[model samples]
Target: MKLLSEVEPEVKVSVKRIDGGLEVKGNLEELGISEGTELTVVATEPVHVHAGPISLRVAGKETVVARGWADKVYVERGGATVPLLRLEAGEKGTVGTIEGGKVFEDFFALLGIEKGKEIEFLRHLPDDTLVLKIDDHEISMGEGQASKLMAEHGGKNIQVNYLGENEKAKISKIIGGTSLKEKFEQMGVVEGKEITLVRKETPAPSPKRGTYVLAKLGEQLVTIGRGLAEKVWVE
Candidate 1:
């Protein structure tokens, strides 16, 4: 009976008990970690990613956003479409594509990062996050949530959470079948959102260990703080 976070790497442990509420239990269960679930711990290292500020000029408007906001914002550079993140300062391109699916499209659409829009990587601003490790199967919200989150991957309908670690899926539909939709919506877990299973933990650590994420929507900028950022995925 020990906290997964406190466990040393390479030690095999079974989940004896999970300390928390239903939300915690549910999140752990989704990752296939529960009582009696035996798993080998791997070297856990904290990985941090910082998003720099990306200045953009959109339709005569000037705005600043976290570098993450421009990740999916594609631009035409040298007749080749590339991520907006690759553009250097003073580089300009046409909005050739808005990837990451409908939810992202709607987000970028509101920011005017759509087709035919002239975009410029005005400049980059600086800014300054964690991930637990397992058998390379980072825990992703699984089981029930995965069951409810029916996603269309490779033309097949599947639960988003049930996906293996590092497995990515696009949420095609959310069938809460009751109040789950509202619950999922509260978390912004909606269709058109792409979800990825990162890592899993035993004894079910906190649903959120406070991972920092910077999400952006083209020229429309907003800063998302921690806590809430871990639970919400941009795509």
Candidate 2:
């Protein structure tokens, strides 16, 4: 009788019921989580969960994808290149190339990944955490705050979560509306402020489930959210 988000780490729990919309349940099912399914809470401090599905046919390695990161993944099908989100359930394509520079090519290289990034893309973690450095302090934003944040970068307005990795850019503009704007103001994130990417991760494995897309690409298990899974195309 506990919400998945409230469960503690290392405690074994069965999914008695999942309360979400059809798309939420569908995404969970695609990721191999459903009712009557048993899951172990791996780490709750970071809000991370690892459910090793013994029955799942998770072909290869597991690498979590992030949102905003998917826009760069291009799949080759019928001699044409398309984004991963464009494919149907049964359709398949080979991940031919990746754009953005060279920040996240390591994961894609294993699955015939071409090459690629300079930020404007977050790690697209499983839960809804988006971390960034404003000034000398690190800031973590929840899903709602993260999604609502729009910063002026590259001469246009973009999601703060979409800031490029290692790419230092001035906030220039912050469109975090209403309460969201107040949240940023409290944390000292404002227009004309320069933000830098905070990269110090050697992600091992995991995700309890949030807004990610579960993709199986060439023996590699990718759990991407924050709109990033679409960046890594697959066949």
Candidate 3:
């Protein structure tokens, strides 16, 4: 057995146990790293692990780990594991699980990705980017963002940004803290709500200025800041 952080790149391993108290265990579990889970070491410097249906950054030289925390995560070499982000174009796999908090889960779920669903991996574009075919739609994502998904190839599961001007789409997900979620929800930006991008106005000539987005949410017209609008995922 060995600590996950100590595993070599491309090595496969099965989690034997996670040694930590409730808080520690809970945090790791949220990232999909737990006992009985199988994964592979994608990298070591930042400690990337393809845990189940998600890829995770476990530990690193700059990351502080509690005493005995990493050691508690013991693993046996050689297990089945694959990360969705690592898949090449033309490959396909089933959605296994997602690693992250409730907000992250909700975000992906709203985008039509969830456990047990089938997805086809498209080609990787420039700037560490890639595209995925989910159902009848194609969603593009960045590599860093895509690494959080886990899947099995021969048997795997695994696992968004921006909208365009003058485009109409249904609300797929929102990415932000509680306050942001509530703020948008209150503005009728909840998932499944159809919205249209009316216009993007330039920032006013003032020190406290910012760009604004005008849109139609249902029967009402709404305006949102560009920063916040970027967090709103549309399909």
TM-score of 2: 0.33
Off by over 4 Å in 3: 1-79, 101-103, 125-173, 179-235
Sorted by TM-score (best first), the order is 1, 2, 3
Per-model CA lDDT versus the true structure: 0.52, 0.46, 0.39
Q: On residues 76-166, what C-alpha lDDT tens digit does candidate 2 reach at each position?
A: 7788866644444345466656654454454334322343311121122334445678878988754334443445677865555566666
Error at 85, model 2, angstroms: 13
Worst 10 residues of 1 by lDDT: 126-135
TM-score of each: 0.35, 0.33, 0.31
When superposed on Cα atoms, how far off is each prediction in RMSD?
17.3, 14.4, 19.1
Candidate 3 residue 178 Cα shift, in angstroms, is 2.3
Q: Cα lDDT for residue 3, model 2?
A: 61
Q: On a 0 to 100 scale, what is the lDDT of residue 105 in model 1? A: 68
Q: Give a tens-digit lDDT track for model 3, residues 1-235.
A: 6655455555656767655455345444433445665565444321122111222221111111111121122222124334454444455566555544465556555335555665554443322334443334444434333333222222322222222343445544454446545644544545554444343333233343344333322222222233332332222
Alpha carbon lDDT of residue 43, candidate 3?
A: 45
Ranking by lDDT: 1, 2, 3
